[model samples]
Target: MTKDKTGRLHVTVRSGRKRKLSSKLWLERQLNDPYVVRAKREGFRSRAAYKLKEIDDKYKLLKPGMAVVDLGAAPGGWSQIAAAKVGAVDRKGRVVAIDLLEMAEIPGVIFAQLDFLDDEAPEKLRAMLGGGADLVMSDMAANTTGHRKTDQLRIVGLVETAAAFACEVLKPGGAFLAKVFQSGAEAELLAQLKRDFTTIRHVKPAASRQDSSERYLLATGFRGQQRP
Candidate 1:
């Protein structure tokens, strides 16, 4: 197994029998994925960790003592990275992770079993973080419906909601990152983020599947109605 800068791990899979087209394709891709191999070697939870790690390497958002909130943190890959980047035991450093699915515990992360769409979720996360966040990231995507348009809209909704909550909890000069589909329907959300942030950009992590329509929004420099 080999891990890449993007955090995807590649594994060898025996193609003993001709399987269904999708299964065969998936198996072949996994076998060729370098990041997958690397993650396994490095003891990371998933290749997704490389996505956040690469982003942070370029953006410098994950600081040693920054407070962070992670949405859809199941399996805790992102949380693990956050805990390490933020120095779990360091003063004024912490990570708050939320997901509907149960995640294995990771050191230095506060885990919550709740859906980000839930009405009470935002307040609950803030309570866990003990106040405003320096960064709020969401790798959340709705379970695919196999219907392209529907899946895109659902993911967009999740991104929009995450952005709204980011405005609520982020400190000035904070950053927000959320998964988004590249269907070009995110104009309104992008515009809003630009208004509230100093800069907004779209990023496609190398770990993300090329065939997949997913991308990420990187918004920085929060400028909203301040909440003390």
Candidate 2:
């Protein structure tokens, strides 16, 4: 590791015979990433914690005594930020997180190891929340197949599912946030969101890698009911 001009450590990885070039590059990127280093120092589960933090700082999404649901919340980075902002750690707020993968315990979060797409997921999450949610956020991403169009479709599908779930359990003034790609195919999704939300915007936080095509869709002021 060597210090860059910003005084951040940059790691260089050598590709061994057994290591694939892609894997070596990924490892190097992770090691040199400033947010990864900050996450470690700050004790967050993943570098993604900064992404939510930056978004929340600007949007004021999380508030004390609010109920929050985190879809695909493995590793609990977003959960951590929500818990802190909502005072979940003090038992004044509620946070329910669900994912297909088992996540280790997070202090103020209720973790459910299940797929959000399951028919039983929404009811289970509502029970865990004990009431309607004030905000529903998802950082879920589909497994990439290296085909851009296919991956984009999958991502949009995931976002749509998440939005549907949000509509089922969110309060009248609730908000929804989900990760999405920059593909132009999101027009349909945006149209749907506009029908359901009073305001919708696409945001790319600084914490998101500049080179990455990933962006977030934020929909605020839910219509309180789903349209036909």
- The best candidate by lDDT is 2
lDDT of 1 by residue, 58-112 (tens): 8888988898999889887888889998997565599999888899988888888
Indicate the worst ten consecutive residues by lDDT in candidate 2.
Answer: 219-228
Weakest 10 consecutive residues of candidate 1 by summed lDDT: 8-17
RMSD of each: 4.0, 1.7
lDDT, candidate 2, at 5: 89
Q: Model 1 compared with the native: what TM-score? A: 0.87
Give the CA lDDT, 0 to 100, for residue 121 in model 1. 72
Off by over 4 Å in 1: 1-19, 226-228
Off by more than 4 A, model 2:
3-8, 226-228
Q: What is the C-alpha lDDT of each candidate?
A: 0.84, 0.91
lDDT of 2 by residue, 138-195 (tens): 9989999999899999999989989988998888889999999999889989988998
